[model samples]
Target: KLDMRRTLSEAINIQVPYNFERVMYLLSGGQNQTEAMLKMEQTQVITLSKDLHAKLQDWVSTYRVEDSEMLGTVQNLWGCHKYLSDPHTAVGVNAAQKFLHGTQRPCGAVICLATAHACKFEDAIRKALGSKFWDGTVLNDPKLMPPTAGSLQKLPEISRGTFREGEDWTQRLREVIEGRYPEATLVTPHLGTLWFSNQAMAMLLGITTAVCFAAILSKFARRSKR
Candidate 1:
């Protein structure tokens, strides 16, 4: 993978295409290694070199490469499809556009794997598209998340522990290879699309309990009145 860690600020996200172990895990029958080699042989892999990644970063915008690329992608996608894409999806958009342009033939329609809800990166969305759309209308405002919730800086405590920060270079790199900290064990070998950790379950339980308690209180109040 491209080591743009030095070039891009730590805050800026660099979403790469794929990691090898994950690919191997998928190709290797997901559990048994019987079909691994065959599956890998059949699979077509695309790699973006460090140089190419840097070039793409620069090409996306002349100034503030990291920030501009993702921001530009979010704006461009929103303009085209009336949908907001996360940084990861924006990376895919950049790659697809770059790939299609390189092709000589007429590219009919390219597929962009839009991952994650755009509201998750509300701050990024706001920075890219502004407080409102071009028409001065808000996108999913008031009742739901606005273009920016302004909470991007404050990452969830559970999510924050996933990185091995302040560790040695080798250990830090190992953390990436392992791809999970104590908090985010869901990103492990489990192939399921949906993953909810204990913390998530606890939060859900708390919310449910609060609602049930409120309902009980309301019923008791009604009974007293009757």
Candidate 2:
């Protein structure tokens, strides 16, 4: 059985991707010879040069956020800004807020990049906010959900392909990709059409145009100030 404690900290309710832990173990010279680590030994690994590593250590400041803190951040952002944030974005925001209040605070705006739509992390959002909040804002309100979200939820059939341990999983994956798996069934597109419609294209074009216009206006405003 896999050790949950290695990938997830039960005390803080914090979970990290398996590959992340693997890389860290390799870099830190951890000695446990796991199957994953043995396989990684065959592949070429890149390391940062001493000078670049020193420069990064000098410039970058990282802060840790617990699951509870991330959840609190999600709640606070929603309450204060009326903005829904996924847990991943909330973690970054929480860390950014901490840095701002810390001794080495910067004198500029701190932009936290949102990784995904709030709907993608429904469980995290539901946990952060209550069921009542989720019902009111998401379940009952159709307008609150993104257009692509509805379509995604309505997908007719989904399948998972599994490979056993000690098997050549990579070769099996290659066979699947090459359409050699007799049991594998290909899914035809629903409605016999592509997912991206002309409306979506138009909306994307409009957003791009608006961003370009805003950039030009900002440049002019800066020049005027000068």
The lDDT for every candidate, in the order shown, is 0.51, 0.61
Question: How does each model score on TM-score?
Answer: 0.38, 0.51
lDDT of 1 by residue, 1-226 (tens): 3334432122243333234435444433344322333344455334444754564454333222356777798788878977767766787677676666654332345577767666665556668888665225444343234535534324453443332335453443344345454233223222222233546534544676799999799667755654
Model 2 spans > 4 angstroms off = 1-50, 106-109, 154-226
lDDT per residue as tens, model 2, 67-172? 7888899999989998888888888899899988887664356788988677766677888998788767775556557777866766765333444457674565
Q: What is candidate 2's TM-score against the reference?
A: 0.51
Quote the lDDT for 149 in model 2: 82
RMSD of each: 17.8, 14.5
Candidate 1, which ten residues in sequence have the lowest lDDT sum? 185-194
Per model, state how many residue pairs clash.
Answer: 0, 0
